[model samples]
Target: MSDQVQRDQTLDISQSFIVQAPAGSGKTELLTQRYLKLLSVSDEPENIMAMTFTNKAVDEMTQRVLSALKSSFKPKPKEPHKQITYELASQVMQRSDEKEWQLLQNPKRLKISTIDGLYSLINNRYPLPSQLVPRQIMAENWARDNAYRYATEQVLLMIDDKQQGRAIADLLLH
Candidate 1:
């Protein structure tokens, strides 16, 4: 198939997918298209999930999707690629503009987020099997530093004041 044809097929939200691409390579554009496609068929926007590696990416995707939805109401040139995206959005608008507008209002329900955002969502909704006490997650670097400090302390406790062990413990302390 032609690349355009493949892109259209990929954007068809009927299928599940994982798309990996380099930075500045239109991944966000494709993701926005897919999101608009989902909105085309589904009444509940909350059911759809769009995840990215960073919060910045999640925000970008959410904004782009919202922009597309808004554009769907306005008139645009009938360019092939844009027509495809706008067409899906138009269908959603035709079904019930009020419902679509309501869905767009609650972004938290929309489920567009980074991996850490998804983790927080899952933890909020479900109990852990381990039954551990719930706590706010520490920042990654801070947690890593604390882990290193604890490990160093444990190693120091294991070492006696013997010359080699004391030297190793001292090195770890510094």
Candidate 2:
């Protein structure tokens, strides 16, 4: 499927390309095959990223690409003994033409992290803009810890309403 696509007129790197495949028309196979082909020739494979909707899909896609690449990734005449390196990854991650890869590799992004990480970045970028204190403080985890301690101290001072106090404590603790 991908071999045909590759063979089909030159896939213009300068222009965007989209293949609209209907339901159950080997879309996954074609996409993955094309992904591997692009990855092989790509100066920055990290740049040519593909996203699947689910973790299962991500796992499947990653495994398929790894396996396919492993099968085809052999020494060639133009590049003898050429192997994909971590340095090449770092280089591609550092710079790329793919927007998806750029977003995935951006140092500024907080991957699967709490909102606190985002707030911290925002605060560091612009304290006033992010509605945070201008001074440098501890990380989000540390601040959350300190807030919990302060809340506990407040609770210990005096609190008759058990439910209200617990709610207050929870808020401060988080």
The lDDT per prediction is: 0.72, 0.49
- Model 2: per-residue Cα lDDT over 1-174, one tens digit each: 584554232234454556666776655555555554454356544445565556666566665444433334343324321222222333333434443444233432212223454455556768674556555454766788999999888776645566676776676678
Worst 10 residues of 2 by lDDT: 80-89
Off by over 4 Å in 1: 95-101, 129-174
Residue 47 Cα positional deviation in candidate 1, in Å, after optimal superposition: 0.6
C-alpha root-mean-square deviation, each candidate: 13.1, 12.8
Could you give candidate 1's per-residue lDDT for residues 50-93 as a string of tens digits? Answer: 88889888888878777776787789747876776677767756
Residue-level error in angstroms, candidate 2, position 74: 7.6
What TM-score fits each model? Answer: 0.65, 0.37
Please report the TM-score between candidate 2 and the true structure: 0.37
Give the RMSD in angstroms, all C-alphas superposed, for model 2. 12.8
